[model samples]
Target: MRMRHVWMTAGTLFAGLGGHLQASDWNMPVGVTDVSREVYSLHMTIFWICVIIGVVVFGAMFYSLFRYRHSQGAKAAKFHEHTTVEVIWTALPLLILVGMAVPATATLKKMYDASDADLDVMVTGQQWRWHYSYLGEDVDFTSNLATPREQISGESEKGENYLLEVDEPLVLPVGKKVRLLLTADDVIHSWWVPELAVKQDAVPGFVNENWVRINEPGIYRGQCAELCGKDHGFMPVVVEAVEQEQFDTWLAERKAAAAQEAQGVDREWTMDELMERGEQVYGSICASCHQADGSGLPPAFPALAGNQALLDEPERHLDTVVNGVSGTAMPAFRTTLNPVEIAAVITYERNAWGNETGEVTQPADIADMLSE
Candidate 1:
């Protein structure tokens, strides 16, 4: 009779939680990949096992406390050396663990095998941005958070994808095994996209490999799972998976754009043109440190507004940006940015805010300096 009562109480407890457990938003998403689905299955399997165990334990405790109260003259009953009960308790948990481990091990093995990938992407983590390079494709770009400052500051209403949106999303094709080689340029960071079931640490000087083959065409969003810097929350990852034909067209267009940018290095640039491009590049890359108003956070990032000394030496400004100061937090942008970007940003900084130098620094001059 007691055993039946305990079981009934356990069932009731578990039934109360069933509704929440079935909620899609409450549980792990059955993601857009085969591996992700397997992971979700494993998660639910273990979760239910844990829920059952908790229900049984708590229900028995509650039943005993109510039915065997001291006021009712109920005495504590103790027993020992019962091999049947001992074996049931011991073997039950062991069997459950083993059952959970089997599927988990299989999924982990599949996740680790990143060989013979159709596409290889080198994902580099920086201060608060992600730089993705399509190996052998001669295409690489940085992805920065695209959420407006107004939205963040509570001055304007937030958009649907406020913090998760980016200026450039890492584009990939569905039905292709795209292997990611992740590493950090500075501190340790993690590239995590839950839908793809790929979470790998991006450690400096160490390459971690993970692969994903999206089964759907959609935009998947994620963020850096590691505490990288002050702007850690600002760093977001967006992947747009499209059809093979669409991906091919996008890649070709990117290639053509890159070639055109290379050609720009040999031509003379106008002040207006440089300022426009420079303002954009500055906003994405330099605005974080130097600030949008050119008033940098001093002691670390010195002010760039109304700084006559820096504005006077155009050559020093160029070299400082290219090579970077050895003992400073500023990393060199020579490799990170192209000649056109470099010249345009420098021109923009010199002319922006209260420091209008009116100098037209051509991409050709920046390219020549880089070659030397």
Candidate 2:
């Protein structure tokens, strides 16, 4: 009984370790994988089978080697061929292979069935962020790492989420099939979430699709599975899977916000109001690479104070913010930010600092441009 308990303990430890032993670092996740668990079971099955075979084969070979040694005065047999032994060895391997292949083929079939999804979301990988668009809905947003640079640099206490937090989490209704369309803007990236059993490449100028149907409603987190750029590790993917009713409520709220934005454009606001609202929006959206004080990280993120691109030419400023300067790190804010937001940000930049143009751009102007 004591020996049996010891074996049980050992077996439990081995099973627990098996889950995380492969990539036992923060590099690759280990909680659960779509095909990995199946693969692991297949591995263990084949491994034990091999162990049994190895023991039998080696036991016979060693027994013959020791018992038939010439030093023991054993007579050498004249017969050179053993058809029975050769046939047994060949047939045994073939049977073992067939056994392994059966389960493997089943798992492969399940992994490849990426159709008939209930929900479809397009996941576009940018240089240092992820943009998600809910198909058949006007809900779309970019998710960025919310972790501060100070914490990342070890200058402060890292939050609970740390490098795994995002400003916006991809929301989904639980127990529903979700199809993800993956692609990249500049380079190759990979979208991976272990719990949901998703990992697909975000290739540039190309689209790949993967599907998942989460069993539970919870927050699932993952990082950029592929190396994107300088801030590759900073790009994290967070998913909030909520109940159907809760998801509907969230969707309704988003639509209301969109409607509010449409009404806000035509209505005029005081400079004080725009500045106040713009400050918050800019801090959340633009303060990562660009410093909070309008003094951006030099060389890479140029300061907006004396920027010719933003100050000298208003057309350039509007164009760059809306359409984005292609082939660069500056992603277009048109889709991410509403007209009122865009106008407020543009106004804040123009009027702020000594570059005082005293020009106020109403949201209506931005809306008109977007229409064009």
Candidate 3:
């Protein structure tokens, strides 16, 4: 009865461990793209090969241990060397490795073939956002984290998408070869989307190439797989794969919107219009480093809520916004933002959060500064 109890306890312990192991099983995700699926297949093939090797080796070991035991009255056979066993062991492992390398080489060849891509999109990684430019399409935009501050700060319950959502997703057409020309504005950031089996490093001053062809239409989410800065984790990548017709429609709409915004550069924007637009631009671009209320995370992101220097010197403020502070996280808005957007955000910063400068910077003022 005591022996039975001991065995039962041992079995229970092992069973619990097995359950935990099962719960934490390492299963490679089978992605929606052909290359992703192929990668997964290769992974499984290698995994199973190792598993089979382990089973055969360990099986023989345990069988020899039990069968050749002294308790079984077995006699030991002594030998100096066995050439057949040695040769078999070496040759077998070499053949197995060669077999594994062949398929792996072919897969790599397929992955690197980015020629004859149907579309080209320039992906520029910034501090905590992604800037996408549709080459030859006259469409460009910056995608920011759309998740609210309240949810991130635990003031409210998390949403279904949570940190995975972005203001604008990288839209692509299904079954089309889309080549990405990746680069970074500041530091190194890796643009990775697992479902597409595309992970390329965006190094500053160097452009890396990667391509993907999606088989299915769906929303795929990924994050910056590089340590960039303070808000590295906040930079998420979202891709929306749709049919060719839908993608074309989206492209056209985006181009039209871009044209309208370009026209706004010549017009004089009112205080109310600038304020409203500035609020939106600030929330998306600036709020990640600076707090939502403009009470920035100090020592890194200085507070704009009651910044006396910013309010007193308007020219200095405009210069700072257009040509960013060197050796710091503040990015220049000259290239990333249009004249209107830069003007509005600056005007908003001066007036909002109880500073109440009541200053309205027109787009023409920004255009003049940029031209200078």
Q: Per-prediction TM-score, please?
A: 0.92, 0.77, 0.89
1 versus 3: better lDDT goes to:
1
Q: Name the candidate, 1 or 2, with the larger TM-score value.
A: 1
Clashing pairs in 1: none
Give, for candidate 3, the lowest lDDT window spanning 10 residues.
17-26
lDDT by residue (94-179, candidate 1, tens digit) is 99889889989999999999999999999999988999999999999999999988898899999999899999999999999999
lDDT rank order: 1, 3, 2
Give, for candidate 2, the lowest lDDT window spanning 10 residues: 26-35
Can you give the lDDT of residue 52 in candidate 2?
70
Model 3 agreement with the true structure over 1-372: per-residue lDDT tens digits: 998998799779856754554335356467888889888789878876897799689989998999899999999889999999999999999999999999999999998899999999999999989999999998899999988888988999999988889999999999999999999999999998877888899999999998999999999999999999888888899999999999999999999998998899898788999999999999999888888899998898999998999989988888888889998888887899999999999999999999898888999888887888
Residue 273 of model 3 has an lDDT of 94
Q: Which candidate has the highest lDDT of all?
A: 1
Q: lDDT score of model 3?
A: 0.90
Comparison by TM-score, 2 against 3, better one: 3
Q: List the residue pairs that clash in candidate 3.
A: none
- Clashes per candidate (backbone, < 3 Å): 0, 0, 0
